[model samples]
Target: MSLPFILFFVFALISVGGAILLIMAREPIHSALALILVMMSLAGLYLMLGAEFIAAVQIIVYAGAIMVLFVFVIMLLNAGTEERTDWSKIAKYAGLPLGILLLLELAHWMAHSLIGRTPANGAGSANVMVSTRELSMQLFQKYLFPFEATSILILIAILGALVLAKRDE
Candidate 1:
């Protein structure tokens, strides 16, 4: 009924619908696009929750960079639309029960959280990385080595890809 609740439902529906479409889409590219819709809707939900940094990361990293990578890989592989196949009885029947269970869990969580929660004026104390100061402090002081290690790992992966592409004849 309230604005925030309405917005939450809107974004939640968009995210869930996108996820379903992503799974149902036959083409790899369409699936990737559907995933982008899900990611962007999740970013909206993050913004609604006052997690600005996470929302930005969701948009920039997952929707922007990762989706681009997914699209590129799909194109590079020349992936085609999936061929329709007969589904097993177990798989077809199992989906409804699983969906209902997930729905019940989500309803329980929302009922608890929305009933008594007040909106924080800004990112709450528990929200790490809400500001650049905390993020930079942790990044440079605490997690610097891991950050550099991941960068090195990415470089190695790029080199491996190049090597594989230019294999000696």
Candidate 2:
């Protein structure tokens, strides 16, 4: 296999392994650490795809900011101890159907994505065309409102987190 494909497979394995560890870990802090590993692996995958700007953004936004927030919240909650996760009797029936549905949805989406992708043009540049001029043009023209809206949403979420984390009166 080619180098890029090999790297992609390795990163995918790391990403999925991290996800599994995050889910199976009993300790919340360990889970958080595993999630950070998952995020870093995803950033590596983004780099392999030749989206250098997006890869950097993924590292900055998810690995740096979001993982810090996750670790902070895990510490704030003092969740080091393993919590009992045994489902109650009522949950058994509900959880079975939910799990089946989730699996079906995942399978369907995977099949759809494999079948419906548009082929990329041959002889095109492998790297993303992310010059400052192109970024500015797309940011202003195509994604202006959504970008502004997400900024507003992030501001509100930060404020909400602060309020929630404040000392109780």
Candidate 3:
């Protein structure tokens, strides 16, 4: 196989392995770290696929911002490995079946819909797509409500965190 092909496969494997670790790790901090790794691997995959903007966004928004927030929440809540052990047996029983069902549904969707779909030609090219411009336009215009709603959600999350952290006066 070509070098690029090999690298692609390796990144894909790393991404999937990171996802598994994220799901299976007992410690919440470890899971968050694994999830960060998964996001980084996915960003690498996006780079390989020529989605440069998407790769950068994935790294910045998901790997940097989102996972850092998750790690902060875990530390702030003082969640520890002890809580993990308490839920281990029941979680395994519930998680395994749920994971199996999810895998089956994903496979079914892939087989029926994704296998036959051809990727849009020139879709990843910066000059051809101008995706950032188009996305900004949509965000400010047609999809403004959804964008505002997401902002509101973030505001609510901030408020909720403050409320949770406040000590009795």
Scored by lDDT, the top model is 1
lDDT of 3 at 127: 49
Candidate 3 deviates by what RMSD? 3.9
Q: Report the C-alpha lDDT of model 3 over 23-127, residue by residue, as the tens digit.
A: 678789988988888888888878766667788999999988888889888998998874334557766899889989999999998788865475543223334
Arranged by lDDT with the best first, the candidates are 1, 2, 3
Query: Which sequence of candidate numbers ranks them by TM-score, best first?
Result: 2, 1, 3
How high is each candidate's TM-score?
0.72, 0.75, 0.69
Q: What TM-score, to 2 decimals, does candidate 2 have?
A: 0.75
State the RMSD for candidate 2. 3.7
- Candidate 2, position 97, lDDT: 89
Encode model 2's per-residue lDDT on 1-169: one tens digit a residue. Answer: 6676777789999999999999788898898899989989998887666666777888998889888988988888887678777778766988778989999999999788865475542222466445656767898899999999999999999899899979998
lDDT of 1 by residue, 22-92 (tens): 98899989999999999999998887776787899899999999899889989999999889878878778
Clashes of each: 0, 0, 0
Candidate 1: Cα lDDT at 117: 75
Query: Which candidate leads the pack in TM-score?
Result: 2
Off by over 4 Å in 3: 1-4, 23-27, 48-51, 73-80, 83-98, 116-130
